[model samples]
Target: MRTPHSHNFAGKTRVSVLLACAALLAGCKKEPAAGPVPGGDAQQGLRLVTQYQCGACHTIPGVQGAAGEQAPSLAHIGRLSYIAGGIPNHPANMMQWLRTPHAVKPGTEMPPMGLTEQEARHMAAFLYTLR
Candidate 1:
């Protein structure tokens, strides 16, 4: 003969198993909420530039480049007259370019990157420090 407390515990165990199964079934469903990170790291963005071999094309001061030819560097992007091939330079635009290059220049070689808005800003900040 089982005690009253044991029966209550058994009922709770069954309820827990049911809730677990419900949760397992819920995991089979799909949801749509994939998006870019809200903010980014500029220093990490700069590091990523080197890590992703961007220096091969761009003539950045610190990073090394294997190619004999180098693209215009960001040594002083903050002070430049224009960016994105001379479409008017601004930190926001620079961040836009850093995030989505193709949107700014359709046939440019520079590709979108792994930087966040904050990171791009930080990167812009770092670049401003160059000169």
Candidate 2:
């Protein structure tokens, strides 16, 4: 039997099925890898953080007496999408920033502490574990 209400019901069912399929496909998508940052050690990184005295200008968790208000808090830095609220939040980018904050962001208050490549890598490793 054909009726106006029956046609609307059929259209609604088709739309519902399409939406359900789209959701199922989205759920099946794989997530990005969450492994340790390459060539970086969290423990060594933590030590370097203390050695560099980063706590003096920045608030860092797990570092005693790192309660600085000059810079942003690094409690969950790993979860941040970008560094300095501008650059992408990736290991390579982070290392570069740590090594050369002035070059990355000119006229900035953060100074170049003269960190070696190894030191930057270790610092990046420690920062990535904040999440």
Candidate 3:
């Protein structure tokens, strides 16, 4: 005994319910991990940052006297999806950039920091904690 109007109303209700369910599922999706790199000590990395004088050109949080305006602020480096103008912000890429900025992106403002592999690893571990 349903009228044409009632049939249309039921179809609209079904579509609305389906849309709500899809939105809920999308909201439940997990994000990528943002923890420190393996075998890289965050404390050591912090010390290395100071030792390397990174504060001279970049503003880094949790670091005293690191308020340089020459480079970008590294407050939330961990949550960033990309860095160094466009490179993916993975641990390996971060380490490579820390070791050789010019090689990663020629003509970039970041100069060669002369960091060893282990040092770069430690630095990356520390930088990732900015989130």
Model 1 agreement with the true structure over 27-60: per-residue lDDT tens digits? 5223211112235444665676667676677767
For model 2, residues 21-123, the per-residue Cα lDDT tens digits are 5865755323212224789999999998988889998999999778888999989888787878698788888888999998888887888889999899988
RMSD to true structure for each model, in Å: 17.2, 12.9, 12.4
Model 1: how far residue 10 lies from native, Å: 71
Best by lDDT: 3
Q: Count the backbone clashes (under 3 Å) in each candidate.
A: 6, 0, 0
Query: Each model's TM-score, in the order given?
Result: 0.54, 0.73, 0.75
Clashing residue pairs for model 2: none
Off-target runs (Cα >4 Å) in candidate 1 are 1-45, 64-70
Ten contiguous residues with the weakest lDDT in model 3: 27-36
Clashes of 2: 0
Q: Global CA lDDT of candidate 2, please?
A: 0.82
Ranking by TM-score: 3, 2, 1
